[model samples]
Target: MPEVVQNVSKEGVKYIILGCGRTGYNVAEELAKETEDLIIVDKDEKRVEDLRDQKYNALVRDFSNPGFMDGLPVPEVAFILANDREANLAALKTIKSRYPATYVIARAIDAVSVDLLQQEGADVVLYPQEVVARTAIYHIRKLHSSRLALRLYDLLASWEGTLCIVTHLNPDPDSISSAMALSLIARHASHNKLNCRIVYEGDIGHQENRAFINLLDIKMERLTPQMLEECGYIALVDSSGPGVNNNLPKSTRVNIIIDHHKNNTQPPSAVADFIDIRPGVGATASIMTQYLMELDIPVSKTVATALLYGIRADTRDFKRNVTPQDLNYAAFLLPLTDADLLDKITSPSVSLETIEIIGNAIRNRKINSGYLFSNVGYIRNRDALPQAADMLIHLEGVNTALVYGITDQNIIISARNKDIRLHLGNVMAEAFGSIGEAGGHATMAAAMIPLSYFSMAKDKEGLLTLIIDPILKRFSEIVGLDGEGEE
Candidate 1:
């Protein structure tokens, strides 16, 4: 019989920890700093006593037995860190079955145990070794990024005169924020010697994008041929290569390129003095955030809000194709950001036409396998098509969504995919690259096909059918779907 330790006040205990081993003890010690409501349970009296000595609430009981957890207060979080795999699995199953609502975090000793724990209803199964290794790697990368930032600072310091930071046409938040961050870095490093300007070719039509620019007070101008002539060096921000989407001529000189999107085609790296293209990163804003942190620059509240919004928008609040760096930068910026401003930037009022367009998309949607296809007929707001596509992709069974509309003399297509196997941008490029201009990130892509490529139709339905049918057929074939079936 194990000796039962005196019960500590259970009034505020929110985290119930099973097992007082090294892992559990360490976790408890860290968590204890945050809250007083923590209880540690173990089968061994010695371990229980050790925890008690460390001033933690400890109990000696058979944690594997379901009855042992019956009378304990329902905790918000439960950690199962038993030394034996069988004991850990049994405790996890018992707690999950009894307290189905509790968030169970279990430690796994091996790969097999990790899978078994997850199967046994462990909400989060963590391998301590793997986590530690990842932490080490992340820190090492952080150091490398610091060095790279200093090198970039030195490089920028060498340049004299205006440094044009160009974004893709009709710049999104990611492009705008990235350009702003780069300009900030360049200005700081050059001590205002190097003049940096954000320039793009198209209109900022998206409501949220407009809010972001106005709220942040971002200064950007329309790009022209003459602008390039006066620029000492050109730096492409949130854009992979020149002439792909921007007004810059392909033959024009590009000194630097910083982008997070994967190049649809390989870029000529030799042409640019510096190129940092990280496709694994969720947003270009994250890449810029790292530079800001590495340089230890004081990030303004407005700038922090812009970067934060840019990251969240691009990553769909970290639900899309996000990486560890994205999460880290987001966390770094969260505290610095103005919450009220972020709310305003994110909660922009949508026009009634945008709402109607979304309704038309849902009504006209065709689902084949897990793919969704919709055409919003003719739309005045081209940006609304992508917004509609993003919304449609969240439907219960849909894994891929493609939304398109005829605007002016072009057919605009916006594609989004949650399925990891399909790269939507590559799909769009392959499907429409030959017909018109098309390219985007891995998960989201857009294409612009000129009306001249298709035969003119008399009515709206006829035009939609003529353009949308070929696109559906081509896209379906590319994604390995055969014979379109309506939902």
Candidate 2:
């Protein structure tokens, strides 16, 4: 064993690099800027000499040999960077046996070696190939996003009039934030040449959703036919097409569609010039964040917070239908988001009507097999249906929950499902598509039937009572339930 040549004092040595390979040398160079209490050792005499020439404390030693580090001071950290798997594992076991307290970071040639290295007491295992592949993938995604951003900019710049960015009716955090992001993108892409307005058709009925908009001060207007007519171009956010979840007329022409919903009815390309619908993504806001990053646009604190909340809400805090892309976008926005504002947005005061609706849903609940159904009577707050359904799904023995309420113009429905065999979106569409609009994701879904469909009834309560049984029966049948349990 060759002794470590002391270029700098080895007193209070805290770090050691066991190889002078490419990764080890690069790490040593970086750590050199932070501390001089580090040494680099390699079996190759020429590599050691080269490191010493650069003023690094270099030594020629066989790290895989037992007792190689016996005379050296116990380092707080040791990096074993040999490419040979057997040598690296041997080095790792030897170091951990002597200095059990030392944090050993070992390099592995592959995943199998990684596990072996860790079992031998490597505190961390670095697979350089995996690291490089991940870095490359991240950059490639950014490059692709930049190309898409440029294409979107070119499309926006091609048109010269006002751009109406539409969100789905009763816009939640995801749709609202997505629309806001698209508006920002439109402003940047057109260089302020396009007048952009965030437009929607339904009320921001959820209390938390209201707080999100009020806290962020997001500007959105109710969509009117005149606004659509005035705009030279139109874009849909969190909505795939006209007359789908939105109140847009079927004849309306859309220029751009950005959504994360899985829609088989109308491909966005058929309805829009620029379409970015990725059903695999948890939120449309994630797609918007990608655009912001690739375009190098400055994200405001408000926008950052909204986009973060949007991702959380759509993904249910990364628990539902989440993908790697959503997480990546969220990580990018986390540092820029305002933590206090997010807390306030997510913890808004609950409304009395919402509580009452939830109470009604619980009181009127009916169970058949594992399916739970509830009618919340008549509701002025349409957003409460989903909240009620979300709560009902948690009941014991229930894998699916459906809540419906009668509004003045529509019979609103909201559903939540955890049964792996069930597809709630398709079930809702099949159950209600003939009389109304309905669709959503697998774990969640919704429907809306015009009250006019049941106008034959004399009164609201009578109408609700008469139609509830049939609707529940139809839904139960669609889900393939065998028997109707006594309620």
Candidate 3:
């Protein structure tokens, strides 16, 4: 391992350990490196003086003061382990104030203190006791539940690590961002190749979302029959079932599924990989955040910002449907996120093309039987479909709004509704089946179709209308709003 390690051999790593008690000593022992990187500090002079006298790097002083941290040669990376919460936090604060550039990972006593440490500039926080307890309980439950037991077995099942097809349900910021982030993870493994493809049948619908898609360069390539046949490993991200938002190609035998939606039912295979589906959490991105923490992977600033944005956009910033996991992930990502990048992603300037789409939505809009409908065209940014749907829903007499558009090679639709009981995913699956695909939550929906659906979409309005109305009629029938014999 030492021979293979291609670390920068420029300078020796300097460690500033705050306590020499059990945990701190354990840390030092773990770091008993051949690189001669050793620095241990303890308050008891008599106990540590002998080591200092023998030429071992040791400091015998009560480093209780935040100022005491300045005297030590803090490494570019420092691991601080003080037993007491207040003392640990103080040492962390002092380390950051002095060595502002250090990558600090601190030992924490509880979950809440981790947040404080992060706020004080600690890059990572670990509560050993709490983690051990959670691990024990999770595994215990897994052992008892045969279903969970098999899935755990599957994650490591050396299917030479096949592709994990993850779906983003209701495909929000967090769901989509998490799917992309997980793709990066699956790609890093030696034998496994993870190809992340985004599939959305409805509109993103929000201006900020439209901006995020443009800035992040997120593209959804529709799945094909050949691609499905070739894939062996499968993972679901946000959405879960066939009858729901996904018509998962029957070949996609799901191995793992990480989600936070309400449970409909568990997936079927005995050898399934993992179902880290936590219903209590607000955002799936939060669940992915916890997984990253468990793997001890360092999230880049962009990843941090993206996860943070996902959580904020989904949970409305810890205000709604936020579980412990949601809060934990938000707390985890907040300090790591780049404030400027997040701001830029959240408030990107609208383009003239976007404005034109909005104009067309209004100019050709219609309202009937509580449904506001419109046919749009030639638009590039897929973000506007849902936004147009949402805007149309705001019309005085509208109960449902379905906005349709035709790009050169695709038929795009964003559906919005004030009806609280309808399942938009089911509605889309039934409506768009003949032409294309649609998937999203009840209040919001989106779909994508092949070029064949839009024969002369380039022709001003004639061709676009022919393609959109039939789909809308299908949707109306599915929702039981279509009159007489419509289909």
lDDT of each prediction vs. the true structure?
Answer: 0.84, 0.86, 0.68
Candidate 1, number of clashes: 1
Q: Model 3 over residues 323-360: C-alpha lDDT tens digits?
A: 77677778888899889777888777776777788888
Q: In candidate 2, what are the lDDT values of residues 1-487, reduced to their tens digit?
A: 3575474454446899998788898999899998988988788988888888888888888877886776677789999997788888888888888779989999998889988987888898899889999999989987887888789978887767799988888888898898888878788877888889988887889999999989889998998888888998888888888876687887788888888887557644446788887888999999999989888899989889999999999889999889998999999999999999999998999999999999999999988888888888888889989999999999999999989988878788999999989889989999998878887878899998888766656577668878777776787788788655736
Better of 2 and 3 by lDDT: 2
Give Cα distance to truth, residue 95, candidate 2, Å.
4.6
Look at candidate 3 and tell me the lDDT of residue 218: 73
- Using lDDT as the yardstick, the better of models 1 and 2 is 2
Candidate with the larger TM-score of 2 and 3: 2
TM-score rank, highest first? 2, 1, 3
Which pairs clash in model 2? none
TM-score of model number 1: 0.69
Q: Given candidate 1, what's the lDDT at residue 425?
A: 80
Candidate 1's displacement at residue 147, Å, is 1.4
> Which 10-residue window of candidate 2 scores lowest in summed lDDT?
4-13
Q: Which pairs of residues have clashing backbones in candidate 1? A: 13-37
